[model samples]
Target chain A: MDKFTVHTGTGAPLRASNVDTDQIIPAEYLKRITRHGFEDGLFSAWRKDENFVLNKPEHQGVSVLVAGPDFGTGSSREHAVWALMDYGFKVVISSRFADIFRGNSGKQGLLTAVVDQSAVEQLWKIIEEAPETPVTVDLAEQIITAAGFTTKFEVDSYVRWRLMEGLDDIGLTLKHVDEIEAFEAKRPSFKPKTV
Target chain B: MGRTLAQKVWDDHVVRRAEGEPDLLYIDLHLTHEVTSPQAFDGLRAAGRSVRRTDLTIATEDHNVPTTDIDKPIADPISRAQIDALRVNTAEFGIENYELGNKEQGIVHIIAPQSGLTQPGMTIVCGDSHTSTHGAFGSIGMGIGTSEVEHVLATQTLPLNPFKTMAITVNGKLPAGVTSKDLILAIIAEIGTGGGQGYILEYRGEAIRALSMEGRMTMCNMSIEAGARAGMIAPDETTYEYVRGREHAPTGADWDAAVAYWKTLPSDADAVFDKEVIIDATKLSPFVTWGTNPGQGAPLSATVPSPDDFTDEVDKVATEKALAYMDLTAGMPIRDIKIDTVFIGSCTNGRIEDLRAAAEVLKGKKIADGMRMMVVPGSVRVRLEAMAEGLDKVFAEAGAEWREAGCSMCLGMNPDKLSPGERSASTSNRNFEGRQGPGGRTHLVSPAVAAATAIRGTLSSPADLVGSN
Candidate 1:
């Protein structure tokens, strides 16, 4: 995963709500071991339509995506976040996001910002009107701004810090190795164990 | 304040908590399957980390395993490699893996609780969303991302933000022919798919208490379809009896101790939930999906919904899209919708009880001409159990193919998928477009409904077959 800080890029407005993971990357693409190069498979089903945002040249290479409320609403696949990142989306702004998708985004340094519904509608309007409108998302400031209009967003403080610092979670957890070992030794024998 | 069952479990599992951060909770069990574990195992190797508690982790081959063959090699190369990868990973990690032919091997959710691995007051995590199924044991079972899976594999702990508790109390007895699947679908249709987001829904009330353990598991299994973090039922004598004699269950002295602790897992009498929703179960009929998502459903007798019925613009758009994709008309009666295939198994409905219910409906009756019916068991053990009870003969006589155990047609991971535009009555959790196969249409139903649909070549409940049965 790459470090994420402040990103300013054109926005592609997704006008749908409850945009599920199955739609983001269908189950057929879930096979294969390698995790990279999923850009082509991102929205693979919808991409066939000529009018999809990504297919339109004006919205090409946009790193920010704005969508309606309740985005990333189904399945626990982190592949959904991978598809978005692989498609060059650094930030996804929605009024609400499924918990798993938001968590997956945070782990990959992709920002899932929860803004007010009015802010989402406003962003959709601005980005739809001007296809090449640049949107700036600053993680440190917790703000998303597009074409002179700005809206504040909320994220967990720890997530913001992790993204800003580009910290590796496994490394951070490993620092407490001794404590984990102590707890494991004291764990109940009656509890189910793997072997 | 009295604590909800979920809150009580969370309080018991807390290993560490700090300001401005989520609580680090101890996980008693971690289940893994082929689709999601490859990357996590790779991460551990890349980071030079070891699985923290191999004894607390288990693996199985289910997602991509075929349901038609038992002793042969996997036909799909990708699925073969994934299963092989799990074999290697589990061997290296010292984790107990129930491979394709193992007696205990099956869908991770099905095997865990049945084998007494999932117990009351425990916190469990899996890379698959259907992990919610184990919550019926009065435990916290949540679906984590692959990255989180790696985190838990390495530490035996997950940092989880607390969730609010939603009490879904179902009152009254279910009308004859109504199943747990119908109740869950009705709840999802009443409250949109995202209704339970950020909440651990605790199912309570008279109706819930009256259900068999299998029925409770079926209800909790589909909690994820409603976007709930977890779904739990209070541990009672029903739970204790289910766990008492399983292979991994505690011995006499330990069993008494375990029961004592389990008795405390239920919510207190005065427990106050963050939110509460009461459902009148007696009013529910056999339910089925009419559109793409799980929420776009109605009673088996109701007509397909018009986009005009939606109050939200986004829902309206989704409804229109669903109608177009489903090839359904606004006024078409749901019961009259024709289906090409009837699927009788999945993580949601592939247990012995489900098989019996389905077989009861199909007994001494032939399937409608030109219709295909498949019965895939949840696991090898379930298959053997069903066969021992002569359910296989019942299905075979009715023209339904009784398949080997695995997740077959629940999703299109295996070869048991419908052709494009082919409609099916599936006893699976999801009905998303192409979920059963690319361009396949799915109508979510119970085993009874699937069996009845097979006999009639249309969506139906056992009541619809009163003349035959």
Candidate 2:
């Protein structure tokens, strides 16, 4: 995972709400075993339209996604996060996000910033009005800033710390290997085992 | 304070707890399928870590396998590669895998519970969201991403934060012709998609307890649809009866011990929940989704709601978009809406009981001309059970295609898919746009409703077929 202290990038506004994981990277794109090269599959269904927001020339390569509420609302596919990061989105701003999607985002180092619906509306307006406007997300400060716009976003503090530190969670968990084994040893005999 | 069922299960699994750090919770069972496991396996290998507890892990080939042509090689190289990847990964890792053509092979959620590997008071995690299906057994079942999957594979535990509890108490009995699918759809509609966010929902009260284990699983399976962390029901005689003699279920003395522990897994009467919602299930009828999201639903007796009916600007905009995408007209009666297909299979409603419900509705009858219906069981075991009950003959005789098990036409990762602009009354979880296929419009319904819709060539419930004969 990459450290995400402060990221400055242009934003693209996805006006639609409840933009689910299926819409982010459809099930068809999940067939690939390799993690990279999902840039083509990001929003594959919506990108077909010439008028879709991301398809607009000015929004191309934008790294910040200012989307509607209830973004990433379905499926537990980390491929959604992979697709977003693959397509150059470093941060996603929404009024709300599904639990699994938010967890997946944190693990992959893609910052999911939850702002107020009022703030979301403002960000959407700013990005839609001027696609080139740069938005800055500061994980250390937990704030997002743009031209004449600024707002503090909420994130799990532990996740925020891990993100800024670029800590590998598996490595962190392994430090407690003895505790895990100790707990396992006490598990009941009747517990089902695949073997 | 009396601990709720979720807190009890969660506390029982806590391997380590600290002040600032999240609880390191031991995982009792880890279920994996093809699409999500590949990346996790790669990550484990990249980290030079070995699976800590292969005995607690299981894999299945479901997402990408075709329901047809089981005897032939998979035609799609990409799909085949993914399945092959699972086979290789599980073999190298020494995890138990039920591959395609194996009688034990099926949708991960379905096979787990049917095999009795999903038991009360366990912490179950899967790479798939519908892993909440196991929560029906009074367990703490949750869906995790690939990163977490790898973490569990290497450590048999997860670092997790505490979750708030919501008691969704459904009082009274579900009226006749209203199934658990309808009850859950109604619950989601009442709560909205994001209403249960950050909370573990426990279905309580008389109506929930009355449901069979399969019915409980059906309700729990859609917890993700409501944006909940998981959904659970307190284990009772119904739960024990379902698990009693399964292949993996404990025998004799072990069973006695298990049942005694399970008896202690429900919430105490004095328990105080973070939130509470009381619903009267007696009023619920056959429910269906008219729009894209699972929450955008209504009773089958209602008409399509106009966007203007929504007071919130966000909901209004979303409703308009859903109306446009679904190609549905406002004020049209839901039952009057025609369907191009009727699909009855998925982790949601592919169980043998679900098959029997649809079969009962289709017996000695035929689907309408120009209408297409497919009955794919949840697992090969479910298929065999349905066949033994002569449900296959009933579906075949009704002109509906009886197919093999897998998650066919649910996520459309398989060959069974809806064509562009096609509409379906599907007994699946999501009604999200393009969920079945690109430009495919799905109206989520119960199995009985799906069968009746196929016969009438419209969105009709089983009760609508009454007196017609």
Top lDDT hit? 2
Candidate 1 segments exceeding 4 Å error? none
lDDT accuracy of residue B159 in candidate 2 = 92
Give the CA lDDT, 0 to 100, for residue A153 in model 2: 97
lDDT of 1 by residue, A1-195 (tens): 667778999999898877888888877667766667778779887898899888998898899998887788778888888889988989999988888888888888889999988898899899889978889998888888888998999988898888888987778777767766776777666676556
The reply for model 2, stretches above 4 Å from the true place, is: none
Model 2 clash count equals: 0
For candidate 1, write residues B319-345 as lDDT tens digits.
998999999999989888999999988
lDDT of 2 by residue, A7-51 (tens): 999999889899999999999999999988999999999999999
Per-candidate clashes, comma-separated: 2, 0
DockQ of each: 0.66, 0.86
